[model samples]
Target: MTVIQWYPGHMAKAIRQVKENLKLVDIVLELVDARLPESSRNPQLEEILQNKLTIRVLTKADLADPKLNREWVDFYEAEGQPAIAINSNQGSLKAIENKIKSVMADKLLKRQEKGIINQRIKVMCIGIPNVGKSTLLNHLVKKNIAQTGNKPGVTKSQQWLKAGKTLQLLDTPGILWPKFEDPIVGKKLALTGAIKDTLYAKDDVALYALEYFVDNHPEKLKERYHLTDDEINDTTVNLLLNLTKKMGFKDDYDRASERLIFDIRKGKLGRYTLDFVPSSENDEA
Candidate 1:
């Protein structure tokens, strides 16, 4: 289960469908995982949505480090992009609505000046699977308009939900990039549950995720699992097995590893965000 490969023909068809439907959308709300915003973004999306007003919304903010999430917001804002960090379940909708309106303010004004008042700004929600697109939709409309599940790829088709007076959301099925050029991006996405777990083995993905945390945020693992940094040696499986043994799981390293993976995905490992930008020096190394 090394780096689960999920190249589905339907993804390409979905891309085509998005292109066909883009004409109907006034703005694009790109949903990204707050923990893995850089990796979860579909690279081709910018190209397909060229010239469209795009607002970047980082979802699941409660599960990510507040400092890092603010850094991401600042980074995007500096680049002339509107970004908001919102925990959808907590009724944080004003920030998202403000950003959308800010981006579409001119367009809305133009319509008003032309006597076409009360036109709803149509927004298409797009993102990789399990990035909380559906959750945000439900939070905005205050209803379960789109089907949602803990697993990835739950929303198979597009649906529209009218959100209040001036906004209507077109929910699209989560789409992945055609090719994950960066292996680290793929691994981070898989580790965070943005990609389907069944596509890869639990132990292997957990090892990769462990290595990532150990290398980037070793203190988080030490603090949460009560394991010394040295204990997180290169052999993640063995480290997890030992930790599980101490945590009261006897003679079940495999089961313990599965639980460890689930804990990481569920933010039990701590509020950590993977790198927002790839380090070129790392890639070269």
Candidate 2:
């Protein structure tokens, strides 16, 4: 397995800025990719947000297994964490607003008792790179205020945006932790575009994706590439080479690897969930 590590200067600065601005916000909206709920979360951000009111926003639900989305939400909610899964492009965001208000109800009531009325909830939006943080922000505020891209590290700074009349969102650049302790976590991030393409070997992640599909969604993989049972059963490396030849790329395995990765990201094969909720907290290791 290839070791994946990418933490640039801007991310370090973003962490400092997040800590500095933590006092200004009433709540935190931690965004994560729906397919990789646990792996996509930044442990560094978790440390910075210590005891702060935070909601887990699982973005890109459309590209992830729908059943897993609900299960992940249940897993978080069962642990007493506020969480919701949304496609951001189409899912209703009313649930997010309602959850925020409900969580802050006590704080709001105290302010109301002191004669403060209609105070907007201040929230900080954060997530790993390319996990749809900016896209979610744009939908929440109903504008293209934050730059959206298919690549990582698009948003470089933080800014505030109004969501309707009640929520004020602080949009920050996607922040990844300095290191990934688990290699699977790194591969999952690389497969899902959370990590930049240049940061990891495409063949490594493509093989990882191929193995995942072979185990979990062989039919989709076979159908997508028109592979026979014997072909599908081939070893991962041989299958990759076969795919390269079938795609008319000849010996350019990198091109084939890139195609497989792009297809997975674009949902050409099918929706998938790389992370699963452990049956119990003790089972997490």
Candidate 3:
């Protein structure tokens, strides 16, 4: 399998721009995919955002395991990272507003005591590509102001927009780290649509996702593809081949792979979470 990594030239420039603009924001809204919460997080951004109050916004809650979504949010909050899970398509924007207000209350209070009033809270929104940052921004501002798409690298520049009377948002392009040290992390991001489809092999990602479903969600997989118990029990590669034939693609495994990946991303196999909460250092990868 090819090593999965994607860091466009613009991303390096994005890092520099984020560092330069850090001082402008009162807090950082770090959006992550709820499906792969830990894997989708950019450690580089964590390093750059040192000492800033950050709200870990777990986006795409509607497509993730509902129980796991609660668990992940609790896990982050327990570790002292203020976190909330949101479905950017229709989740409560007021919840996001309240979280920002709660974190900035102390600082805003101090400024107001000195006679500063109606000061808009400045927020820097950062996340991996396609984690729904732009959709959240557009919803907050109640305008289709940010360019949004189902693919990565859509938002390539920094721009500021207002959200209600209390918030000013500085939206930044999504950043992927230079390398994925853990191969599974790369596959997880790819499976979740964080990496562009063209950057990696679809069959490889499909196989990775297939194994995950086989292990953790067999019933959903069986139901989605009408797999028999024996078919589900076959070797993973053979299962892919069988599925290709079953779908009437006549030996076109690559097309089957693409269809399987799309089904997973579109939640046709039901809500799933690729990254489990780490219980120890050895379990983290």
Candidate 4:
């Protein structure tokens, strides 16, 4: 598979902008996709956000495997950090609000002690594009205050908005690093819409997706398209061929591949986690 990399001019600007404004916010909400938490995370986060309180917000929890979601949360918390999983759904939003409040409790207490009660908590939301930063912002405020789109680079600039009377949120453009040293990171990012579609080969991505399910969620393939054991265990190319035939695409493997990707993204196939969430034994070691 060919290596995939996409770093737009705006993303570079966003990196600088985030650093410039890092000290202004009380906390940094580092949003990432729940499926591939490590891959979706910006590796430069610690460098840009030095000495800043960062709360990892794993967005799109509804699209990810729930068991793995819990594991990933435990993994992050094991490092003495706060991690939260949320989606653009009911019940989860309230949980997100509570998490933000919980993290801000100490700062809020300080404000109260200084005779400044009801101070608005300032938060800077940063993450790779299309990981639901805008969605989270809108949910927190209960309105479409920021633009929302499926594609990346949607939020080109930063905008501040109020989430209730006590919280002020700064939504910044999704920033990706300059390069992806590991090709798998690019593939994972591309598979989850973190990377632009034009940069990667969809056939290869679809093949990887197929291999992932074959190894981890073979039953999902059976439930989605009813593939037999042979077809499930076939080579990536053959699997795509089988899918093409089953979907009546005949020789249109590209369309079939795109369809599979769409189904995976939209949860029509099944909930999946692209990365491994380590077990307790691995964590303790």
Candidate 5:
């Protein structure tokens, strides 16, 4: 399989540093976009933090389908993992705190048995860029303790925050894997805005997004633009252009495409998640 690898020198250094610092934390709170939970995960993380407990937080839940989010949560729980869907901007931090306590229950009990009182469980927050790690930190602490931006690579250094009496969070920069073994993985990352749009042409990204939406999420197109499946299949760009015109664009096809791309990125079409997990039958590929 051809892999797309783009790990900047700084990120490699960061990963090495994180690996070296993993011993300082008691748990890892791995943040992933709820919309693209499977695709958003960094596979290398499992190997790096092999023996540590991990609590997966699916951030940006408001922008993902509720039903799919529930399914994902169930999937994780069934695998003996703790997972929660949450929106960083909304009032979901309390639930996150409760889940953190739940995941660290065993460790907390061990500390209690050892006569350790008022011990704080240190958690390292790790995820890919734009997964809302910093936003989550701010929400949990009720203050802007971490530097946050709308784009990727905003948080560059690691800072520790006290989430509560029982938990402390080590916030780190969002990190991407050194390589994407699957092309679809790279495509989904781009589609979900994990990779900056400035790195590639909007039209090309939109084209791939258009095809994926048409194939896996035809109902979203129908609901968002009143486009029928046949209309969507006929011509993706033209269908988008017509929808843009109806939405009060200047009736220019190129402009319409641009607007459609913007809407897709901003979750205007609907809460949609892209799946890129390779099937078991095709695992060799």
Candidate 6:
């Protein structure tokens, strides 16, 4: 088991910033990867922002299994947390706006009863790096206000972006936990590009994904790579080699593995999720 770890100085500082800025926002827009919701969410978030109302967002819904997306939303809603799925790249953010309005209705109503006019809703968007926080921001603002890239740790600082008259957005760099208790969490994070590739072997990560597909999404794996039943049943390494050869990748397993991972990231292998069932059916904040 690879013990993947990455906690840069900036991330520590980001955590401190969350504490410092928690009170400034009326709600926390906690964005998490749709493909790996359980692993992408920082375990420390609920404890850290317990005093604030949070709306859990399942981001990159376009790249995850649609059924799992609904299931996750149901799970969070069952837990009493408001949840929604979005495809930021496709500008699917109207529901988030509606959700924000729904959650803040009572608060805004109270202000109106006190004769406060033109109430504004402030939200802080937080999540692990590369989970599309910036993309989501751009979707909501409909303008390129935040820097977005294909890798983790892109947003290195905090900035406030105004989204029209009544809603304000606080964009912060993604914060990940210091360490992963379960190695599988690390693998899932790596698979979803939450942790930087510099910290782990790309080939190994790709192999891990292939193994997961073999067990949980065999049809997808077979369909994408045209793997025979024998190949599917073979050892993972051997299956990878066979796939590499069939795809005319030459003798380069690493390149083939990279392509496999890239295809999965692009949803070429179909919409899949890496999260397992929650250990308990009980609701968690």
TM-score of each: 0.89, 0.96, 0.96, 0.94, 0.86, 0.93
- Candidate 5 local lDDT, 216-250, one digit each (tens): 78887788778766778777667666666677765
Q: What does candidate 4's lDDT look like per residue over 49-118, in tens digits?
A: 8778888988888899999899899989898779988775432555766787887788777888999977
Q: For candidate 6, write residues 222-254 as lDDT tens digits.
A: 888888888999998888889889879878887
Off by over 4 Å in 3: 280-285
Tens digits of per-residue lDDT, candidate 2, 142-185, equal 89999999999999999999998888999998898888889889
Q: Which runs of model 1 end up more than 4 angstroms from their true locations?
A: 229-237, 247-253, 277-285
The lDDT per prediction is 0.81, 0.90, 0.90, 0.85, 0.79, 0.86
Question: Which pairs of residues clash in candidate 4, taking residues 3 or more apart in a chain or in different chains?
Answer: none
Clashing pairs in 5: none
lDDT of 1 at 251: 71
Compared with the true structure, the alpha-carbon lDDT of candidate 1 equals 0.81
What is candidate 1's lDDT per residue for 1-285, written digit by digit as tens? Answer: 466567676677779889999999999988898998788889899899998889888888998889889988888888898888888576466766788878888988888899997788889999988988888899889898888887788888888899878788899989987567877777778778877766656666667777878887888788888887569764877776777787788977667667877888777778888865444675887
User: Which residue pairs collide, candidate 6?
Assistant: none
- Against the true structure, candidate 1 reaches a TM-score of 0.89
Model 3, 138-228: lDDT tens digits are 9889999999999999999999999888889999999999898888888888888888888888788888988999999999989988999
lDDT-superior candidate, 1 or 5? 1
Question: Model 3: clashing residue pairs?
Answer: none
